[model samples]
Target: MTPQRRVTLADIAAACGLSKATVSMVLRDNPQVHPNTRARVRAELDRQGYVYHRGAASLRRAGAVNAVALVVNDLANPFFAEFAAGVDAALAEAGHVLLLGSTGESVERQHAVLASLVEHDPAALILSPAEHSSAARLRRVLGARLPVLLFNRRLDGDGPGDWDYLALDNRAGARLATEHLLARGHRAIAFFGGHRDSSSCSERREGYRDALAAAGITPDPAWLIECAPTRQEAARQTPALFVRDPAPTAAVCYNDAVALGLMAGLAACGRRAGADFAVVGFDDIAESAFATPALTTIATEPRARGLQAARLVLARLRGELPASPHTTIAPVALQVRASTAAAPDSPLQSSVQARGPAA
Candidate 1:
């Protein structure tokens, strides 16, 4: 027995009693086609098990790709998850498909993912790059034609490529959180979570240092604690904050996850957040509001940033963006809650007055 031939636009057209172009227009979902005609063609196409190969169709057209590619460092993180959701929502509204990939913060995996995505011929790419992603490496993998929007992290090293940048105001956000703690009379404050080498972490650290400097308080070198940005790592590294004499009364966490984790760690260490210790986190992820004692956080509006990222890449594809490398630094806001408070014995101090010994 011979295999059946694949369905084509001509076959659908003949079956629908319409011209091939009309069937093609219906397949493309072009509004120019009459609704009645489009409905009839769609019905016949579905009945015949027709598959419209988007890649092939895009190839037939001039300067077109069927999908927008989004590569995020870690989808498990709530902030990035929300950001990716916003990207998908905006792309869907614009009638484009989203091709998604994850890197898990591994640069080697990022190279592989980008190389594979390149084969699909995406119109543009939005990447929340993995740790230590380099400009030269990305340029070699992506070639010069692909329009890219770098989210959150900058590429490693100088002479940054011409990719567009959408970044959170890391420094200002950290400063805001630190200042909030300072206003509550906490003198020794720690900047916790994330490796210092990461650009976002470095910027936030600078902000924390800046806030301390402005208050005529220099941050202790020991007070700047480093860990993986994840909750587990932050929790595991909590003991480091108390190793020095006159431990921090407050902490500016890298993000909400780290803050929530530190809160749990504080409890295990017999310290109560919002009481003996104050905590402030960045990236106001949804869980921050509901965490035990509720977290004080900086709101970076991750989902909205994701939407902005999609818009930026789409603009690049449409030739609406400048030829020069452009950066959009999103603003942040401080959200105060139960997790942060004044020093234990200070005037206008936190409601719970018990302090962990030796801190």
Candidate 2:
């Protein structure tokens, strides 16, 4: 027996007693088509099991697909997960679909994913680039035609070539976290989690250093602990804080995941957070509020940042934004909670008390 023929626009037109152009208009949601005519066309198309060929349509239209691509370093991390959800929500509102990819922080994987996404002919791409990604390498993989937005991470170069950037105020956020600890009398504070080479991590570390310097306190080199920005890795590395003489009385962690893990690690080491040891984290993820002795963190508001990134891409696609590439540095706020407090009998607190009631 011969295979059945595929359904086409003409078939639906014939069944609906409407012209093929009318049926086509209905399929494209053209406002000129009458509502009743649209209903008939849609019913017949569904009954015939017709599927719209988006890829083929994009090719026919010279590479205009009704979807945007989002690539992030790690989707499993709550920060990225929330950011992706925000992007998805905004895209859905704009009647566009999202094609997502996770690189697991591998540049090779990012190249592979970008290559695949480009074949789909997305309208634009929003990327949180993997560690060590360079503009030259990404440009080679993405080519010049596609408009791109860089989120959170910056490429290792003078500037990100012709791509719009949305950067979290990493240095400011870290400074805020560190300052909060200092205000609470934590003199020996460690900076924990994330590799030193990462742009975001480095900026945060600089901020940490700035706050310490302002207070005339210099952190020991060993206090700057490096670990993958994940809970498990942070937990595994937490014990290192106590290895040296004059260990940190408090810590400013990379992100919420690391902070939460450190809290667990503290428990395992018979030290309790917010009491015996103070901890402050960056990125106020959802779990931060619910963690035992809620986390004190710098809130980047990942979901809102995601929405802003999506809006930026959408605006660029519509030609609403200027052709000149620009960078938007999102501001962060410190969310104080139980996780951070005055160091137990700290000399800093004693000195402050000695100064006594601001004269």
Candidate 3:
């Protein structure tokens, strides 16, 4: 049995009375192609049943690619979902498809995913690395040719020195959240969720510490809660914050998931967020607003950051970004909502009031 040959761009161009380059431009959705010509080419394409296999096409055309690889640490988180959507939008706008992967915050899984994607010969890779991902290890898995963008989480130690970096202002965002909690008359504040080793988590924790130090308050070790940066883990670890005699009156959560989870945990413990306790979250994921108390959070605009990441990688591939590893740290802003309020009447709040806000 003879199989039908796949339709080629040349074949489409010949039938449409246009050059292959013009037909290719039309296929790419390039805006410069005249609308009439684009319509003509598209009609011919439909008639011929032309299926654009971009990956296979890349193999045949040297130094040509129209696909990007993206690996995020945890797809379960809504933040990554929104970020991926942004990446998709930017890639589609540039006529590229995204090859997505998740690592579940496991370094071993990340290694496997990157190795598999490399086989596809994608033009670039944008990664929100799992915790403990190291540049030396990544370099071993992914050789130097592939343009890389490290998003959100930084690779451990020295990072990919030559890769593009697009990250949220983690330290600043956490600082803003902590400062807001302080302004609400809460002194015994806890930095909640997330392990302290990951760079993003550490930076946020640092910001929390900075705000506390600035207020002349020495945070108890028990008050700095550590969890898996997930709702389940955050809820499980909630009791750790209260083991001390005077427990923190408020908390700066690692992200929206943790904050929402903490709120739930607080409910289980017979406490209310806006009335009896205060909570501030980071990475204002969509669900933050509708949480029981309408969470107050730091808005990192994950989708916009995703767009910025995709565009940056595309620029690197096109020689638009500087050769010396382009780095972009997007800023964050606080969104105040119902989750936070004046600290509940407690001995800790009174002691703090008596001393006044840390000078």
- The model with the greatest TM-score is 1
RMSD of 2: 3.9
Per-residue CA lDDT of model 3 for 260-331, tens digit only, reads: 889888888887776778888999999998887888899999899889999998888888877798778899
What global local distance difference test value does model 2 have?
Answer: 0.88
Off by over 4 Å in 3: 1-5, 8-46, 53-56, 346-359
How much is 171 displaced in model 1, in angstroms? 0.8
If scored against the real structure, what TM-score would every candidate get?
0.91, 0.90, 0.86
Q: Which regions in candidate 1 have their CA more than 4 angstroms from the true location?
A: 1-5, 14-22, 25-51, 350-359
Q: What tens digits encode model 1's per-residue C-alpha lDDT throughout 235-317?
A: 88898999988888899999888998898889889988888799999999988889878888899999999889998888887
- Record all residue pairs in model 1 with backbone atoms less than 3 Å apart, i.e. clashing: none
Expressed as tens digits, the lDDT of each residue in 199-314 for candidate 2 is 89999999999999999998899899999998998889988999998799899998899999999999989988877788889999999989888888899999999999999999
Task: Write down the RMSD of candidate 1 (Cα, Å).
Answer: 4.0
Question: How much is 153 displaced in model 3, in angstroms?
Answer: 1.3
TM-score of 2: 0.90
